[model samples]
Target chain A: MNRDTLAAREPLLLGAPAPVLAGGGAALALVLAAAAALLGRRELAAPGLEIVALVVLAVAGVAAVLLASPFRAPFTAGAHAAVLGLVLLAVVLDAAAQDGRNAVVADDWGPMVLPVFLLVLATLRPPREVLLGGVLAAAASSAAVAALSPEPLRGVAAVLTGVLPPAIAATALGATTLRALRRGGARAVTRSDAASVQEEAVARLEAEAIPLLAAVEDAGTITAAQAERARAIAAGLRAALVADLARGWLADAGFRVDDPDGYAERMTAAQRTALRTTVASLPLADFERPGLASVRGQDRDAVLELALPVAARPRRTRVAPLVPLLRSAFARADVRIGDEQVSVRVELTVPR
Target chain B: MSDAVWTPRFALSDGLRAAGLWYGGTALALALASAALVVGDLRAVAVLAVPVAVIAAGGLLLVLPLPRPVAVAAATVVMTAGATAALVVLARSAAPPASTAAFPLPPLKIAMLAFGVNAGRRRAPLIAGVAITAVTETAAGLVGPALGVPWAFDLPATAGLALVALASSGFLVGGRRTAVARRASRTAAEQDVLARTRAIARSRAAAVVHDTVLGDLAALAAIGAGPLPPAAAARVRSTLDLLASPGWADPAAPPDAVGGPVLAAIARAEDPDFSVRLDGELAALRGLDGAVEGALAAAIEQCLTNARIHAGVEGADVTVLADRDGLTVMVADAGAGFDPDAVDPDRLGLSTAVVARVEAVGGSVRVFARPGVGTTVLLAVPKAAGP
Candidate 1:
């Protein structure tokens, strides 16, 4: 899988996990900031709380923009609290500067930062986080205003104006976004599965049926040998595709396969897929023979043992290419062959 | 890294890329700004000229039309070191001419800091450069206050701000390259796997044609010459049955092996007087790869062919021994046995088909026999299940 595919696994935040949306949201905020800066071009009469407030807002804005990137380290739980801390500090500074003329919460531009802080977090966090986080943030903002402002009533009302819009936006939009993400992931999986099914069907056609079809197309006459060849190819195709017998090993394992005793979890998804493919390819059942080959091993150990009965020759040529793949995946591979009175024994052990 | 050095298209491209210019340029600009920020120290500012020029020249080389690897490295090293040394002299030697100092860093100190932004280096190297600058500037902080050095300086703020710029720029350059390198390696490994798969498929087709088509054609020739004999007919039927199996081309293990398991294959193929023996858990063979299993079966088939044609005996012994590492098969016949080494090298029966096939699957083979004694052929393979 590529980086894009790995990123696709993440849940969409507020319906904007894609690059265009992620970039657009931050760009929209930046453009708005620029517009606000242009509209209210007030000269700084003095630099005290105003400078501190600007600096805090700038830092918060940069953080917001960086957080908006689709590819990012996962945001932590305390991250929202950190944003709240910045707001707390900014609100305290703004309030201290007002000196009782009016609540700092009621200051012309002081309280505007609350919503921006919330939006930054809402767009980055999961839906449940947005829900719980929005409440905590609103309460904290109100508390900051209440504790710091001399006019508690006016302060609460002003803080509410700052917090409510973004809080609602984060909750409703966040839920919808998560739902869409879930739907997208499921749809992608379904499409991929369908494609594989079609591919397998096409491969079967090419491998078994096509040879006979090509022969018939090329030669009008069908000889007995050719007819026999077609029938054999058909049977071979069936044998390759379907195994009717139950494996003796599966019965021995005591049906403790669902959890796999930590073995399944320990392996990477790719390794697990490879294991399944290898096992499925092995000829576990033969109509003419009762027991030919089998695999038996525990997950704790790296080596997986394969016991194959030999007659005239061992099945080494067919098994050789997989050796490099196995060695790359596992720790070691060893093959041993022995002879008995009527049959031969071929054994292979691969450890990881 | 070696590819960047060797390939003409990639050579020095990372260092010379248009994106790399900003790093060196920013460092040089910061150095110049530091020199400009001095309050009333013309002497200190004058002293900044030499190191500032060096930093500018180095930064220019970094951003030039095509930056060379050797030149870029030399520039970064010389400029950073030279600027730090110049700042140290300004800090320790200058006298405090005024009581009030508005700027945090003197011109020389600022230049040292500007040079500290080694963006080509990652976090560790960038931080080290900044640390060295901070240490060098501490001479001013320690001596200026104690001995009334002429110029005023604020080491803490200057150090902190310089660290941030240097660190951030360094991280940006290093992190991006690291990500690109990781992606490149993954793609190369995947491509190798794809190529190997294609090769295996081709070789498997060849094996299939050799085993089935050629055999059938030769049988057909017999039928064309005269009526097909019973044995010939049986042979044709057997060939057809093999062709009808899935993974017929080169199956390590046949998905639909006729008659279930190894026991059945042996029972059907063995002569009346032949015997069988099994050792170890049969379950161990459960998940063997089809190709590996197919090789084992084919080798066994070859051994039986050799025995029937050359052994001149009705009875043979087959014994299977499974171990922790793998399993082994031994085919022994008590008949007119010949020296193994005496077999014609041109005859590709036991040597090429059986031995080579078994060995290919990471298995081993041993043949032991003497005149008037029994012959024993052993084959073994090892494998692991990959998810």
Candidate 2:
């Protein structure tokens, strides 16, 4: 996609924010350092290595926080890996300080730190990044444990069995959270688009109608040209009324129509008159009269059909006074007539 | 969404919800403890009884109408009684006395009272349910010693305590239901008033449409007229258009939204000089409804118009504020404020339209001004009673 399309999509979701990721990364590092310090309080067998690890973690966390705004592109994916790599190095150093004793770093406290890396990385990055981060967590765990253990092969196997679940579970949770947020953002965008459309329509109506209403109220008299202008304005208002009705029906998505044709039959006598009156009140020439007419939309149906009858001649009734009103008021029309019938049946579908 | 011609759902009392959660959670905890206690005993014929009663308790809560759970209530009582009989036999068969009464409170009695009292619409069911629970707990305690199983409480004391506890819980629940029922009835009465007001408004709207729209059409169609003056003809057409369209066709009512009442009131209170500025968190206000809003809007429009014509301001400044409980709009203008007391008592505009309109819907309007200072009409309307 081009820059314009990218900009458009980013406005709603605004692709992986760096500050949040950075803050979350620093928080994880603090928690890990705190956990290590608490666990080591009993006895820091390798005091110099533990101090170096703790110092490195603080510097990296400070860098992550201070540089979050500038480090937007690829740095987001490596947040956890950076934090964990420092911890792993410290562990390796501590083990080395023990004269090749792996147990000093390979103990329960060190390996338990692997899951926190998984959680932080999974939560901060997108799905693909999370998947990659999980892979790195597992690999790092296996390598760290093996280097610190007497039996390297057994350490690799143990890390795979015990540490892998947290890595995978955290990754899945992060991916799901990312998916839900994206979906919600898309829904908001869709609603905003619809609202803007409605707003535009309302705006247009006011622009055209406001001046004309003001002119009528001001002049208190109509010239032939003004009458012609009023005729055009009246036509727009007529279309607006029908469109508003159709839009209302559309807004009610679960609306249903159990019996399509019977919908017209279901209208009360007064309702039927009101329906015709609503349409007939529009301004149009005599030639535009509909030959037949029927009432539409009353249930949950998306399509609001106002059936108008087309006549053989210019025979007019209360409903079929203007055929053009039905045409302008509806989105689509379905017409049917028998050979001997007085007028053809035209079912106009009002647009949502 | 609201119209006089349609019938909506009957109101659900909030007491029913609290009662359900309280009873359902209570029964579940009791059922689990009872099941764990008796699980290892091989002689438990009715080990399934306590668990089934828990399921029945959930079922009772699930029913929509609280009074209509008779079948579920009957099923529960039978299950509890059977469980009590089985537990008694097992306890009698056991060697230890303390083990026979180790359970905290009577599980069967608690389940029966909770579910049975839940289904009560009147006082009889409550009384009978409590009695059954007390009697059964007493029976279980009394029979324990005969079979060499010593119970925790003396039979009489156990029975008396059970009766007191069950009766208290039942009566308390019933009282909650009564209060909820009162609220529901009040809501219904308000709904009835709302429907009647809508009907009257609809008729008034139809009459206006008939008088102005059809009347203009007749004037246009008359053959006796030589020619319509431009002003006269223009008036007819514009008037007809407004009268016939959806905006005017709709009997205006309060919409749910913080600015909705003010905006709707603004829409109908159409004047060239009347302008509006709205503020506050609007998301929660959308559920507010009915003629009360329309009335408030119309009143605001009236205030703005009154300011323009009487107070000598170019246009009125309207500020809308919405908070948790209700909405308020302040229409202020730096114009010649008047001695409100000196105004003619017969002037019907403010008294009839602004004051009366808001009052009808249980709202208030305050007008403040001085000789040189501007006028500020503070129009405040509480949210209409609803969910």
**Residue B29, candidate 2: C-alpha displacement in angstroms:** 32
TM-score of the candidate numbered 1?
Answer: 0.32
Candidate 1 regions exceeding 4 Å error are A1-47, A67-72, A75-84, A103-111, A188-352, B1-387
Local accuracy of candidate 1 as per-residue lDDT tens digits, A1-352: 1111112222211112222222333344334334333333342223375457555655555555454333233344565566556555554554544435432232223334444454445435654666566566657667766665566655565445434434554444444544444443331111112223224444655664546544543443456766566657655644543331221122222222322222322333233333333333233233123233333346444323434333433243222222322332444433343441111121222322
List, residue by residue over A88-179, the lDDT tens digit for candidate 2: 56444543433234432323333334443443344334545555655665677567666656656544544443344444444444444444
Query: How many angstroms is the interface RMSD of candidate 1?
Result: 18.1
DockQ of each: 0.01, 0.01
lDDT of 2 by residue, B58-119 (tens): 43543445445455455445544554554554564332324333332233343444444344
Task: Tell me what fraction of the real C-alpha contacts between chains A and B each candidate also makes.
Answer: 0.00, 0.00
How do the candidates score on chain B by TM-score?
0.33, 0.37
